[model samples]
Target: MTNMDTLWLAPALVCYALSAVIFIAGRLTRTSRASGWAIYLLGAGVIFHALDLTARGFQAGNIPVGNFAQALSFFAWLTALASLLLIVRLQMAVIGAYSVGVVAATLGASAIMMKGGRIVLPASLQSVWLPIHVTLAILGFSMFVLASSVSLVYLAYESQLKAKRPLGPASERPPSLEKLDRINYSLLGWGFALLSLAIITGAIWADATWGHFWSWEPVESWSLTIWILYAALLEARLTVGWRGRRAAALTIVVFLVLVGSFVGVSLIDPGKHGGWFG
Candidate 1:
């Protein structure tokens, strides 16, 4: 990381953090311009983030996913890009609030993880298979993060309805349950399909490199577990006529398992895939 890189990245990180704050405040106050401003700030952050990451990648001769810090920074960048896609089409500014909050939080964590240090990529991480697999993993997880945020918002709104509480000005603006549910369902399909392919590609990589496709590594085991969990959720929802509260609850649960698999297990186990960084 060069001093010049830090000079540019610092503002981007600041913008992301500011965007998170603005999103939350906008949600709370029902401020109309807050959403637009949040978008603007997020856009700036994304631009700077891309530039900074691109510079780093050019310097390193790769996309910078060799270690936990680099992986997370790359993931956060993708999540922000994904959030922009989700936010532009939806009228739900509150969803933007929820989405940016997660992105910002993740970026913050990435900053902490990277903390003026660079990763030393191992042979495995430098392989073509690693970035392809990790990119898919990040995409899958980004959907999970967005889905979970939407789910959380849906549940909160659901609770308010059940409580018969007057819609506080702040809470009045969340999207309808039907809309939220539809987004959640769509995200599940996207996340699952991509993650399934990720598993296959990962296995291929494992076989090519490790001479075996399945190591039952802790991360691999958890990835399969999460895949099955989402698969079941999708099955029950589409075929079993599952909908509403139960499905929403399951969405939240799936995200928890996802977090455990992506971050928790990586921290504790840091298997062959993660051994280079942690």
Candidate 2:
């Protein structure tokens, strides 16, 4: 990366970290004001992050997902963007207490991984569909991240309620269970739509690049598997009227599988996307 890239990325990372700290503080003390301010800080971080990616894209003559570090960085940025959207739309800034920590940790890992040096986008992935497919997939995954985070909060909040325990004094209260469930359901619906589109575009890109729609490669197979799981979850919720604790628990479990499939499978399997991280 260039010096200009570092200049943009450094402040973005700092803002993300500071936002995480503030989010945590607000949640612990039940300070809505602190959570509210963290949103602006996170927004500033996203702007700086976008500038950094733009700089790298210009330098490399392509979007900056050519390397693992760049991919992780991009994923982190989108996750933060999704978090902002969820919090604002729901008017529940406390979600950031969990969500922003994930963003900060992801961005920090991306920064650490940046030492691998620059990589150019491969010719095979240079199609116009690259950004469309990648963005949709990452955005969908980001939504899952938010859903899973909210699920955790829901489970914890429900547990306290069930136990009839005092929740951090009278003035300090978490979001209602109904609100958390609503957020989870909304995220799942939107994420499923995006993931479905991503898979379709990916198949088109595959057919264009490799003369086949489905290679049954590890990456392709895992992507389909994750999509099926998400689809089933959503379907069950819609048909069986699944909600609250059961749905929240399953959402967390599904996301773990997703992370393993996307990150672990790509690193271990000697398939089309195995070398992506290297």
Candidate 3:
């Protein structure tokens, strides 16, 4: 199973890395032709990644998120999938270029961790909610990643415009500020909904598995804090008409907190969810 899994993942990694390179080079060279080809390469990488994860699911008799490595790999797969879908809709290859490299880096980390040995799912987690909770959490996190990436681009573009600086080469011109802001809001809405579901399902799972609904575990506390933070951000955007630089900056900051909570807390602390890194 490991050997077969590696066979599919190897090509997927290659495709992701090559796509990022081609996209970056195209941007640097200010040529649309290379960027066009880069999109196809990214699509191919997503296909290969999907196949590898599907195979792993069958082999493991469950979703393949039994450890930190598998979790990260699944996260990369979902992020790449979301990026491809959004890039096609936005007709923006540059955004894909900006994000695909991060996806590749995530997969690379997963591959490195895979060498440690096979990871077994804890018996306590072998429930129907396993897929439900993990998928919702990871998918929500992926949307946050997309939102923050676009937010960073929005910030840079807005700063340049305010300074009356040139927008630079055609390849470097991100989507307009209004468009970036709208996309960020849309992604955040979706992420918030999914994250809310993930939290609820996790609570249910905890009760069934551990006879408790809420433990205030480190990861759980952090998750709730992230949820509240986004909720406030969205409320401000909706009620206070928050948009542009302030919105983008807050989105990026929220994402940083999420990363610290998800990765840092989950690995360092030994709470219920933290020790699942295997």
Candidate 4:
């Protein structure tokens, strides 16, 4: 069963790698078929990833999120899932390259951790809120990933426009600065809202199980900090109609802070949530 379950992941990783290449190749050649094919490949990858998660869940008899491997794999699935939902709508092939890379890397890490051993899901984590909190968190993180990648592209798009570069080949990809900024704003709003819900749900679960909430754990503190940073960015973008390099730069900074708070803090000194991913 373990061998069969692990086998579910191999095709997913390969498909992700293939999809990324196809997306990039499509962009370079300005071919619609490339984008179409890339999405198809990504769809296949998402399927295998989901199957891997399901197989692990069946083996564990739970959500398969007890430890690092499953947790990481779950988020990786969500990220790809998020991209799948957005790409067709956004029609932004370039974003696929970034999203696929993130998904592939996370999935790769999950595969590596699986080499250690399968996690024994702690009975303590068994609760209705586990899925709720994790689902929200993964969705929120996926949004942040999309927003940051869009911002990076925006900066490059803006720079190229500013430099008066010839449209020779560069025009084949990367949406206009205005469109990219709009996409960024849209992503931020959704990400912030989801993240807020994740925090609220986490607090509620804490109080229900632990008899209190707001423990000021490192994870909790950093989560709030991230919420605030994104909140400010959202407000400024909405009210002041801010755009351009500064907004893009701040978006990237917030993404880094997210990494520091979640991944970085987990590595050094994690609270309860540290072992999950940090």
- Would you estimate the TM-scores of all the predictions? 0.91, 0.93, 0.93, 0.91
Model 4: how far residue 106 lies from native, Å: 1.1
Candidate number that wins on TM-score, 1 or 3? 3
| Residue-level lDDT tens digits of model 1 in 1-278 | 55745865777889888988988887677665767888888889899999888877775567777567777778888888888778877866677677788778777787776746454466555678766887898899889888887887788778888999745566455578899899988988898988998999999998998799999988889889899999999999989878777888888898887886677777787778665374
Q: Relative to the true structure, how large is the alpha-carbon lDDT of every model?
A: 0.80, 0.85, 0.85, 0.82
Please, what's the RMSD in Å of model 3? 2.0
Q: Point to the candidate with the largest TM-score.
A: 2
Q: Which lDDT tens digits does candidate 4 get at residues 23-71?
A: 7676566455668888998999999989888877776667767676778
Q: What is the lDDT of residue 241 in candidate 4?
A: 73
Summed backbone clashes in each candidate are 0, 0, 0, 0
RMSD each, Å: 2.3, 1.8, 2.0, 2.4
**Residue-by-residue lDDT tens digits, candidate 3, 180-233:** 889999999999999999999999999998899999988899999999999999
After the best TM-score superposition of candidate 2, give how far the Cα of residue 203 lies from its true spot, in angstroms: 0.6
Query: Between 1 and 4, whose lDDT is larger?
Result: 4
Candidate 2: C-alpha RMSD to true structure equals 1.8
